[model samples]
Target: MHHAFQIADREINVALSRARTGYRLHLGERIVPVDLRTGADGRAWLTLGDAHIEVVVATRGDDVFVHLDGEAHHLRYRHPLDRLAAAAAGHAEDQIRAPMPGSIVSVAVAPGDAVTQGQVLLVMESMKMETTITAPRDGVIATVNYQPGQTFDRDALLLSLEPMETCA
Candidate 1:
């Protein structure tokens, strides 16, 4: 099984395989574990390479709420496994992805549009919920692949932006 989740504007992918069962994670590095379990109390307990982490996961429609160390966080969705594969496959520097599977509800910019970092680029609808996609850095829109009412898979490239060249 494979999964994807998002944090802020970053995408993370995870791949799980069985027997010798293991889960692989792509988070700036490869993380492999022998076992994983979700507790009845809504916490996920993972044992990987002698490291242990307790994660609390909550899913409401398409929105995910996570709490760790008393800090609450909400994420769209992303697959660390896909991210790892993409990195290994050489897509290291490029536009970011949607991070989760959803329908594009609105596109805020078109090709040739200049945008600043943190600008809202589009809105996506998932499980009846809406999530906004934003620009990660200042750049000009190179392309808009999907539009309003179109559905995309997790990690799907919704748009790409080209960095503005400095004249020096």
Candidate 2:
């Protein structure tokens, strides 16, 4: 499968093709041979060239956190459909929108609330199913445009987040 991943503020194109030995990893202009094996502890043992490494991976939503060689890296996969929709909407990543026509069942956050990535900010109900809305990244809530029990249309803006400031 071919995928686009945003890692450390850079977009990387990665394509994986099954090979006789294991798999071929295509990264932009470079093609590297790779072999993967699962260890008893559930970690992935990856071999590239003469180097062997063990990596631990955890996933949350569409984001992946990989631990390798005692270092952690965050990877966000941008699916083609999501990229196209973002392009069409011209929306910033900080905006929170309703995924479908739904009534706000609860509001768990308010303006100025500090949120970590993947923290649930609210809950909405559609077709009798409740969906939890989560923070996209670590940030402070900038605004909340809806309240509990309010109805919203699909793609309607529900809230906005401001990036957290960092100390130099």
Candidate 3:
């Protein structure tokens, strides 16, 4: 079985072939192998190369709560394949967007603010789900595109960063 999944605007394709238990993933031209095993606790363990991931999935209709690495991730899984894609997308390395339509709950940063990578910049609420937008790099905020109480569409540009200059 082969399938495609989307998470945070990125797409990934997975194929389950020959061996059945072992699968091939086409992640943007990179072919990777995945192995799944069931442990004594009945949890699904995913192995990718030398790294291992333990996953616990709890679902409520289309919404799912996944626990891994001592952290809880709230996601909406429309399709079974999306679970893998969302997991692979992980966190953003650049700008963050509303995974779904949401309202701005708060603005935590301002224009010209110096923010460290991973610092929270704002909170968005949608379908009773609240998600935090964070800085993806160490830089000064060059622009802030929204304010508290405002609403944004998926892929809306919420902020921009000014790269720091090197001291010569």
Off by over 4 Å in 2: 88-168
**Model 1, runs deviating above 4 Å:** 1-92, 166-168
Give the TM-scores of the predictions, in the order they appear. 0.49, 0.49, 0.45
Candidate 2's displacement at residue 93, Å, is 18
How many angstroms is residue 150 displaced in model 1 relative to the true structure, after the best TM-score fit? 0.5
* 1 versus 3: better TM-score goes to: 1
Q: Count the backbone clashes (under 3 Å) in each candidate.
A: 15, 0, 0
lDDT of 1 by residue, 37-148 (tens): 7888867875666777686777987679877666888987544434533532322344667656779888999988888867999998877878776676777788899989
What digit string (tens of lDDT, one per residue) describes model 2 on residues 1-168? 667789988878678888889989998788889987898887798788568999877899889998889999999988744653453342257777765577999999999889887798988898798877777678888899999999987668889888778311
Report how far off residue 68 is in candidate 2 (Å): 0.6
Global CA lDDT computed for model 1: 0.70
- For model 3, how does the per-residue alpha-carbon lDDT over 78-110 read when each residue is reduced to its tens digit? 443233224324333234445555688898888
Q: List where candidate 3 sits over 4 angstroms from the true fold.
A: 1-94, 166-168
